[model samples]
Target chain A: MNPILHELKAKQWIWNASNSQGKGHSKRLTTGYEALDSVLSGGFPSAGMIHINSYLGCGELRLILSILRQMPQHEVAQANNKLRVFIAPPFQLNAEFLLDEKIALEHLLVIKPATQEEALWSAEQCAKSGVCEAVFLWQNQLKHTQIRKLELAALHGQCHCFWFDNNRQCMSNLPLTLSLLLSRENEQMQIKVNKQKVGWAKPAINIKLPFKSRTQLRFKEARKAVNNIVQLRATP
Target chain B: MQFDTCSLWIYLHFTQLHLNVIENTQVHDERELAQPRAIYNMQSNQLVQLNESALQKGIKHGMGLASASLLYPQLNVHEYNEEIEKHALEHMANALYLLSSDIVLMPPNGLVLRAQNMLKLYGGLGPYWQNISRCLSQLGYRYQSAAGFSIQACKVMAKCKQGIISQERDVIEQQLFKCSLAHCDIDLKDFEKLKRIGISTVDELSRVPLSQLANRISRYSVGIIAELRGQAPSKVTFFAPSISYEDYIELLYDISLVDKLVPVLKHALKKLETFLYVRNTQCLHIDVSFYQREHEPLQIGFDSAMAIYRHQDWLEIASLKLEQVRFASPVYALKLVCEKYEVAHASVDDFFTHKSTHIETMSLTSRLASKLGQQKITRLNFIDDFRPEKSTLALADIKSKSLNHAQSVFADRPGFLLETPTLLQQKIQLIKGPERMICGWWDDGVVTRDYYIGQSQQGQQMWVFKTPEKDWYLHGYFI
Candidate 1:
């Protein structure tokens, strides 16, 4: 090997194609959706940073809720039990929905920071604290350095952090465990793998969501109700 | 002398308490103590205490301030403050409380500890006094101490600068007898009368009969002599340490910036650490007050999610909080007060697991809350109500009511709720619902609506509701 190649290998900067096939299987956290799991090789990485780029109300949070609901509660005796922190969430998390999903309300913490800096600080702190199981941060934009810091913190704490960014159109070429782009089309959630640590980015996959829109039937029903009342008024 | 039966008491007399307090709190260098300084008594227009350099410059205690200033024109003089001295004495007693249990605080710089009880526990009086003197030396206060059978004898011996450290009654009595009558805490008129009678030393006073001495001096002076001789019991009140923690530091210079308050605040927090450690207790909340020069004192409060007693942790949290404060004026003093304390509980970590960082959840929450306001960090709670908005409680409004374990009658509810319902401008196709909720008739916030889970063309799921007046509003998001 050349000197430059040796140095790059030493720094772990060069990705070896052979190394991917060999012992590169990191622990995977099941994403609850079988099809989505199959498309991502297994599931989400157990620990480190994952960036999800999608618009709000596009089942982005629902995708995370499925993973959170299945995550094992942290049973460390000294630590708080399975704390899940949400930083800079745009809207209030509905306790009813959380309870219905069986996520413990007591272990849930939500931080609504006033500025982007504070939100980033809170996310890093929660991820590095080693007491939280997962940290979900919703921000408009984050610098590359901020994401790198959050990634290092997550690795140190053995926590999974989902960075939800809705503003960025294309993902930056940051070295993250996973970067996913989600969109809704044809009554299905389209998940595109933009980057992954261990494998090549896969093409987009569509997973039909559970919610079905029966718009025509409801519209006809409403119109019939209105028309029947009008016919009764005319006869009287 | 009944030395074995009677209790031995040690009296510590701080001769230059006010000056020592000022030096200990402010002087960062040992060379600062060599400066020519004196504490002037404003009432008497005389110097009450002098440092070695001031004494070398021909300044003496009780010398008129004008003469002292004339002798050393560049002398630094501070007016004697009785309140600061009293507080310093109490602070010393609080520090000494761990070594000795029975302490009597004599205000304006004096502490008398019952050494006899602690002697047996420490194996001997020598070791007990060694422990006490070590604590006192660490405090950096200049004091003279003497041990005797009675409090009055100890005070008189200490005031005379005997510096006796013996439990032997005969040795203490000999030192007490050599003390002059002027230092016996007697009245000025009694001292004058004693001078006329040629009883200048306590030995001569003790030689005279009590009945004769009673006629020459006041009854109080007679009682003092009797107490000094162990003939009458000395009524002493033992000092009880306060449960709550409070420590104040007067800065040498005015601190205009928040960063400059860190060192002084760290010192005060170290005191609190010891205060809590000695009692094996921790505090959840502490109030820090900054005494300003020209404005109302600024007060900032810090609270921990869990009871904590470590100074480093408190300092870290305090500095974070201090960054947010805008100082109105320069602060001259800082005080930390903690009214509530909880018993310190030992937290056990897993021995098998190898982790790089181990932070408690409560500590993390506290760290966040310290930086961000407390209202910013909150836990989610479910409320027992029929209305969708009322069913989920707002952030930080934690109520202790048992969560209604019963499953929701409606199955499809949105994951997130908006603060207020907005007009449903975008057309949304109904997915499910027509869940009618006609509750809250008694309360001011009534809800009579039909809720439906709807999806827009962008594949966005929204919770829209129609009120009785046929107005549609979006209330929540499925995501």
Candidate 2:
């Protein structure tokens, strides 16, 4: 076998194959997808600030929601007292959509900080308080010091902090535990792990919906159909 | 009138009664020694009450102060103030008023309450007892309790330090009979006479006929026997629930900083909590006024979006409001006035339980409203109209507002609509179309548009409309 292949197999075996009490994989919160979990060596890093850069309308929010949908049943059971905070989202987060996605609304808290400064402050407070298991912050711009403070806060509170921004230049500058870039191509989402806390880097993870061809729900008709579905599904 | 055997009367006996109050009065006092201490009543010149230490030391109540001092030379002695003791008991009764309205003041150091009616409200007697004990403990009272079907029975049982709860009249009578004559609150002269006659227990004294008992003691002895047998219909002044709550704390030292006022505020809040619990209400509006030597009282008032009953929640909001206050002068006192109150809903979650989404949202929005002004937190409200411009967002109110259920005559609206429709200048490919909507014909406003979901040359999905004049306008964008 090639030396690189042998090293990769050994690393994979240690983190993914082993379930014993050896010096195996460090605890990571699974992304609720087995394939993604295997590639990411269990899943996303549990502590420190993770920066995810995604193009507009690239299903970043959907990815975060899917991860949150797994929390109450999995990650939250370990630290049962923590809250999941969503701060300063770009648009109004429909609580109905969240509930339909199986995210526990009682454990979820949405805070709309009026300014970027307030958003940073609220994010740090939630992270540093140890009362929040995960803090999701959506801000397009931030200083290095702010990111450092947020990372320290996440470490202090033992929280999984996610910063969703589209600034690729700043993303490279920050010392994040895990950094990913999400983009859409040919009706599929490509999540590329640009940085990691440990192990060798892997190829981008591609996710394609199997039902899109059957519905022909793409583009303009898709938007209308989505709106109609949301209206029909959520009433009072 | 029929005797209600279902009534469960609760009696609270303060064991370290006066000492507990004195300790709380001395702010930040934490000396909790196990030394034997007695409170001497100046008028009676007797040791009126003592701690468990004194009881273990064989010191008894009503012992001469001189004899007690001579017996235990190193014993800690405290002067019992009648006024202070009455004030403390009234405060405790006011707190107990939350459990039931039938609170009877036993004066000096005890409270008699009718609790059977609210047993189910707190789940059961065990939980109710736990809640009452917790409340008293929070108020810094060292207390014991007893329960019975009658006021006199519970009081006598509490005085005898039996601490038994009995619903059956037979069991209560049996327990009352078992109490020693010295511990029973009978006439002292009659007590002495009964002892001389070898009647050491209540059963022995009850063996004497009413006429024989009256010969040796006052005729009140006959009433006592009737009460003990659950046969007397005694008059009790039922506690009236207060409509509002106001409590104050005089700081031991002048508080120059706002944070120092927290301890005093906490003490007053406990009183407010008890006050609200007894009334079964929540504070809707509260005012905290700070007083100084000569400065005009600075009052900070806030109204909650919903009735707030939790002490911690109330204190949290109060502290948030307090952060904005700068004391004009050195503060010596703080007064909490809850002028407006609303009967809280029965389904309110316990303090330790997770609050329902509605409450959590309301509290969060209310907090944000206070911090960022009410106008800042807005909610999208659907308006019944064909024009997309007419659909407005309003300031979110405290009450949960359901989305408008009025079915729109049109189909396929974009989530993000432009404030004003701009004339489309680019070539567009229509995917779905011709959903013609004609409305606003009345009141001098008329609109006729052929709406369609179109894709621009740049692949931007748009909600575009064509007017009767053949002019096209871009209305919204689909993400």
Candidate 3:
């Protein structure tokens, strides 16, 4: 048997507690980016922490949009798996935008935690609840020492964490599987995947974004007509 | 084998009369039911006794107050108060149940324990008895018990008497022995007479032959003799009798406290429904009593099945039942007892349809009902009279209806039919159509209306209608 599966099942039996009470190791958080996923060893679902500093200038939406684009619908589907994605306190996964992107909203649950502890508690609950796949967390920035407990919690829960630290710095105790230092290089953002177990061709990779052209005016016009019809029927 | 039937009329059996308890209860203190229990009785310690306890030494049960006073100078006796002692009894019962489940009470006092199965579990009667004694000592009940394979032997062991009864081997002999029998509680009166006849052993009694005892012992005694011989059967008194639904709420000033019992009532009603279904029974009478603050209990009898049957139905009925109950005090505990029951068979198809239809209908109706209220929830039943509103009408589940299949005309019904007709209200500027529809004359009410399908500037469609009186009314809209 897999060690994690065995440990979980063993814990279940020895607890002697009825299943009515929920397990205490669940995690429910928002994942930040999609493309940086390849840099993650076991895709962030390991025993460590990684600091994400988005160098998207114009700038934040630039990298955010690119990262969102790189996220494969299949991976998103698998990671979500009947769990509704909850954003930060009082924020929800943008329902309309997610639907437009073909994201399944059925399993996307949005919860608002009043405190940081509550947010962590929700994550622990999700992990121990034996439900959901990857958990993503987007916050202003966590202190370097606080990341240690978070990494441990994620490891214990056996789920991935994509933590966004807006304030850029090289502090202490980075349990991140992927030590990324995102910077603007050669007019395009460069994502340096710095850590052990770097796969394939290179330890670093760079890519140009806005991979779509400003073509198809007729298509735009067709969309406008359809929207007009929707608006016309709004009053009835 | 000591029974001489010619000498006795009544018979009974007593089991588990341990020596330790006999000594403790009789020789020592009798205030065992209250306070920090006075556990053991010291030998030759003469303590003043309660008058009732003193009377029990040699006096009969119901002697007058004057006779009792004459019998004992300062008889400090108190009547057996069941209420105060109930908690103590319950505690003892719980402890005893942990040790043995089949501990049947001989009532007001005494207990009968079956030792056959336990003998193997505990590795023999001796070890079992020792464990029980240890447990009793721990509980401070300080009681004694005795066990034997046969009823007479068991009784004799408890009472410390050497009473006996003959055993029967063949079915013919068993039948001949137990034929003229009357059943009753275990009364040990016959065994007393047998000892009086100078016949004390069961071995001697068996040799005397069944025909001889037939003329001597009463049929009751004969029954007891057969039971001892493993011929007469013992029916357990543990089965509580089944009755119709009855419940009483007393001193219910706190509705929140009574709210806790709602789920319990649901489970009980489910069991009752299951029971009724199994035995093919139907109940028509339901009664509940509610007692107010230290006042007499007020009762209401619901004699119609249509009044309430299911749990949901009962909620409303209970509210109605409570409406008549005037509260005098905050209610502590309520009791519900149903006394009458009758058999009624349910067909297999009806039984199956009842469940599946409930599931199917509830799925659709609950969603609709959640949007609406209880009064608005409905299921499609055929109209008994073909008329508008009467035909395919909506009625509260509070009112039961039977489906009529004959005039059912909706051969092609739409799935998303409106719960109720939606009245159209739109900016009716773009299009207009008041096309006429005259309906409901031939079993479908006499109706005349000019219906209109209109499209607004916003591209929305509306279904409007105009009566023959030129009264324009918006009916509905096609989104």
For each candidate in turn, the TM-score is 0.84, 0.51, 0.34
Instruction: Give the per-residue Cα lDDT of candidate 1 at B117.
Output: 89
Residue runs of model 3 more than 4 Å from their true location after superposition = A1-49, A54-90, A124-133, A139-146, A149-159, A168-172, A179-236, B1-185, B188-190, B198-222, B229-479
* Model 3: how far residue B51 lies from native, Å: 36
Clash counts for all predictions: 0, 3, 65
Q: How well does chain A score by TM in each candidate?
A: 0.76, 0.69, 0.53
Error of 2 at A75 (Å): 14
Superposed Cα deviation of residue A217, candidate 3 (Å) = 8.5
Best candidate according to lDDT: 1
Instruction: Write model 3 residue lDDT over B231-289, tens digit each, in one string.
Output: 54554343122244433222212333445445444544554464455445666555555
Per-candidate RMSD, Å? 7.3, 12.4, 18.5
Off-target runs (Cα >4 Å) in candidate 1 are A1-27, A30-41, A69-80, A212-236, B1-7, B28-38, B45-47, B50-77, B117-123, B211-214, B345-359, B395-406, B432-450, B466-471
- What is the two-chain DockQ of model 1? 0.34
- In terms of lDDT, the poorest run of 10 residues in model 1 chain B is B397-406
lDDT of 2 by residue, B378-414 (tens): 4444556657777544325534446454432233445
